[model samples]
Target: MTITTREDEERLRLLESVILNTTDGVLIAENDHNQDSKIVFVNEAFIKMSGYNKEEIIGLSPIGFFAPDASSDELAKLKDAIDKCEPCNIVVKTSKKNGTKYWVNVSVAPVSDGSGGFKHWVYIQRDVNNRRRHLQALEEQNKKLKEIAWIQSHVVRAPLARIMGLVDLLSEHHDSEELSNNQIIEAIASSANELDNIIRKIVQNTENVQNQSSL
Candidate 1:
């Protein structure tokens, strides 16, 4: 039988106090290796995160915490790690008691008993829904920027080439046709220069935006 001493009890209480007040959600469960695993304890942070009381979740399998319809690869990977008694990290979506769904990063490790077997699992969880959304927004912006760049390269080419050819024709036939008035030739060249400057500004602005997102 194991003996309980005042010194051991004091140390245990100190550890419990730290877990109880931690910012990240902490959960300890019996390592039944699957949906059968039973939750043994949860910290205050976990209670707040899930909107569930200790009495409501304890002694129940964690299947209730995960959404039944969620069949994502991350969920499957977490299950596989548990079956192998290994440590794993994954971001998964779960529903609170009020049915409000959110994303969290779960880091779990198997705790071994002295007899070469895993007796329990320790899980640390933190919310990451906002971070995921920000990344998705950045991806969408990058996609649109790429489409704009492609249009500038292909669609604008024919018109710009035509402007260059017209300028060249003016230079060669300056004394040929009555249409080659000095004032008229100068106006056309000035207009072509303005269009070139506008296109350059658009390309430069696109590069600036792309660079900011990467940083």
Candidate 2:
């Protein structure tokens, strides 16, 4: 039999409360040969995050358990880490109980059994869907900016230069051996139209960068 003081009980309650209420999902998995890294314990936050009950979560393999949509390469990498008994941090798309998918960052570390042997793996899962969306938005914006730059530097330059040269030629001579007056004006109009189209494309791309990030 064991004895516990009032202070010990209070401390235990505090620990349990903190673990249950924390926003980050926390779970413990069995690490022995018999268990094959199946989950043994999960906190309330994990249950809420996974959209599954505590009973359903327990006894399930932590790897690919919540993230069925996770790629094989990601699962293999995590399996390799588990095989080596090393800590691993991976981000993958996971499905909730409702079948909707979200991004999560799962970090797992080996927990010692106090006998100099590995006993369990403690996983800390953080929902990172917002972060992933923000990153993708930033990437989209960067791509648009690069395209705009290219249009300004290369595509826009050609038409503007053509327009400027045509105007200069019109100013110098209404009719020339190289071209007629109407031909020069037609060339100028064509260059202007091309420049207008390029500008519209750049504007469309910029608008896309702004609108597509709503996802």
Error of 2 at 37 (Å): 2.2
Which pairs of residues have clashing backbones in candidate 1? Answer: none
**Residues 1-215, model 2: lDDT tens digits:** 24668778889999989878899999999865754678899998888888999998888888749447887887787888777778988888999999889999988898878998787898999999999988988987788789789879999899999999999988987686779999998999999999999999888887887787664
How many pairs of residues in model 1 come into backbone collision? 0
TM-score of 1: 0.73
Task: Give candidate 2 regions above 4 Å deviation.
Answer: 1-6, 64-67, 168-175, 193-201, 204-208, 211-215
- Among all windows of ten consecutive residues in candidate 2, which has the lowest summed lDDT? 1-10
TM, every model: 0.73, 0.81
lDDT (0 to 1) per candidate: 0.78, 0.86
Cα RMSD (angstroms) for every candidate in the order listed: 4.9, 3.2
lDDT of 1 at 5: 83
RMSD of 2: 3.2
